[model samples]
Target: MPDPFSLSVIVPVWREAPGIESSLKALASIREAGHQVIVVDAGSDDGTAVLAGPLCDRVLVSERGRGAQMNAGAAAAGGNLLLFLHADTRLPADAVTQLETFMTSRSAWGRFDVRLSGRRALFRVIAWFMNQRSRLTGVCTGDQAMFVRRDAFEALGGFRAQPLMEDVEFSRRLCLVSRPYCIHSPVITDSRRWEKLGPWRTIFLMWRLRWRYWRGESPESLAQAYRSDVRNA
Candidate 1:
């Protein structure tokens, strides 16, 4: 018999009331499949928690940070597999079937390919590079919808508290355990940030940040720079 397993998708959000309901509603099929969906709210006063409550298995309150919030959700997750998804990203239609195959694979962690929800040609170009880079480096961003086996995640102690590049940091450590099983089906991620900053500017900004991070810059300083860049834009 195949190894029976369950999945828990943990989404961390803050003040995302406008889109929380829609995001959670998309996961209703997973919930009906006996999987779990947990939403972690970082004290969103915008009723984000309230909007997400009925849609998920649990709505948890946690410290204000993506890494911290995800850690809290992971702590409460009961499934053998855990998926850390972004609020503005939507998984592929066959995500559950893809994951079932992953559960039987020897790989301990994986991530989906990503596409931006923008009509621009540049958006496709950007996603192409993002996926290609991840494939070559064995590192992934949160937009890719990172997932891992529960035991593997626990052994690594989950995500560390960081203001930025938490996903990058975690992916680095995760790569040391086992290379990720790259899923070809893409997740559609919101392109609002890119469109807000202009695609070219956003691309350059990300390249600069990742270069700085590779050069041993502190995440706090990088985070401050990111906020400044976004604010100035």
Candidate 2:
């Protein structure tokens, strides 16, 4: 059967073997109803590309960076919509259909949903905050599965190859063109990072960074400190 969505799912990955396989399995269950899932490998040392090769439509390699990987995948894609997903994030089953409907109805520039990856009460608050804040500010994270119309995506020149917050930057532009749909079903991201950091501390760091971003600091600088601190701990 011909795919109804004519959409492409782009997953940016780096050193994500453990969670990658599970995420792929979930994505595979989504079926090939007319969409292609491409895993953009950011030079993963964990052999994620090898494992994902047979599962996804295509596995692409790029320098070790999320922005670069996503840009590469978007350039190689042959679909009308480009959905940038994270390696550690799981999309809803009807993600493709919802994206297609939005694109078809309004020719949507781009949209993203809330993230639900943890069971903790604090995690729920943070996730809810992310959803609300993005709607108010036009800034979103990659874990949200940002989907954009092909032409609109190209016009933004894709995501910058920064080490962080490239999703927020691209989304800022997307918001100017159209209001994000904010899909009802949210994407669930792996909570390992936050859990490892201690939930409260992790949420604190996130809120601090977000506050800094609101105060005009570069998101990369804020995120750099947070992610480095996490990796170092």
Candidate 3:
């Protein structure tokens, strides 16, 4: 058993009106246990903050970017361990217990494997590849629900205020200090984006963006391209 520590789950959301309620509801057990839950809304007009306000310990309004919103949430968190969760991601029932145990014994920072919530067989393959790639590179994506020791996060200066690939950038910096735990238990994430964009197209675009990013392409340019592709898709 590892030393006990409180957890603060921070969820950065934008226009998540459709899923925010259910996501919060799913986290009821953790909240009931007196763990903190903070939802940072990115100026969503869809009542995202309103719905999330009563469910979470705190609701904050921030600039309309995932990275910015997440940093704001982390700034307001009270726990020693910070878990950054996606609005559409559903954590396992034992996530809180698992995290408490893992954090005490494992690396200072870690991420769970992701399971895409869809019936398509390709979704499984995509998740498998994603998990394997992350393991190989010691990099975890946002959808995988990354967590870190609060002191380490502050020392690393939180996440970079980039329009895209903030998780990638953060992971790169974090791995310089320690390798991620890479828990095998999975968090299920909604596959709406992949479904809407066509899985193959999304996969190709992601690979292209990652390749360009690795080659030193500007994040602003990559973000613009990504947004354009999403809109067109």
How far does residue 209 in candidate 1 sit from its true spot (Å)? 0.7
Q: What is the C-alpha lDDT of each candidate?
A: 0.95, 0.78, 0.93
TM-score of 1: 0.98
Number of the top candidate by TM-score?
Answer: 1
Count of backbone clashes, every candidate in sequence: 0, 1, 0
Error of 2 at 8 (Å): 0.5
Q: Which model is ahead, 1 or 2, in terms of TM-score?
A: 1
16-56 per-residue lDDT for model 2 (tens digits): 78778787888775545756788899777888889888888
Writing each residue's lDDT as its tens digit, candidate 3 over 1-233 gives 64458899999999999989999999999999989999999999999999988898999999988899999999999999999999999999879878877766648799999999999999999999999999999988999999999989999999999999999999999999899987788999999999999999999999999999999999999999999999998
- Candidate with best lDDT: 1
TM-scores for candidates 1 onward, in order: 0.98, 0.89, 0.97
Least well predicted 10-residue stretch by lDDT in candidate 3: 99-108
- Using lDDT as the measure, what is the rank order of every candidate, best first? 1, 3, 2
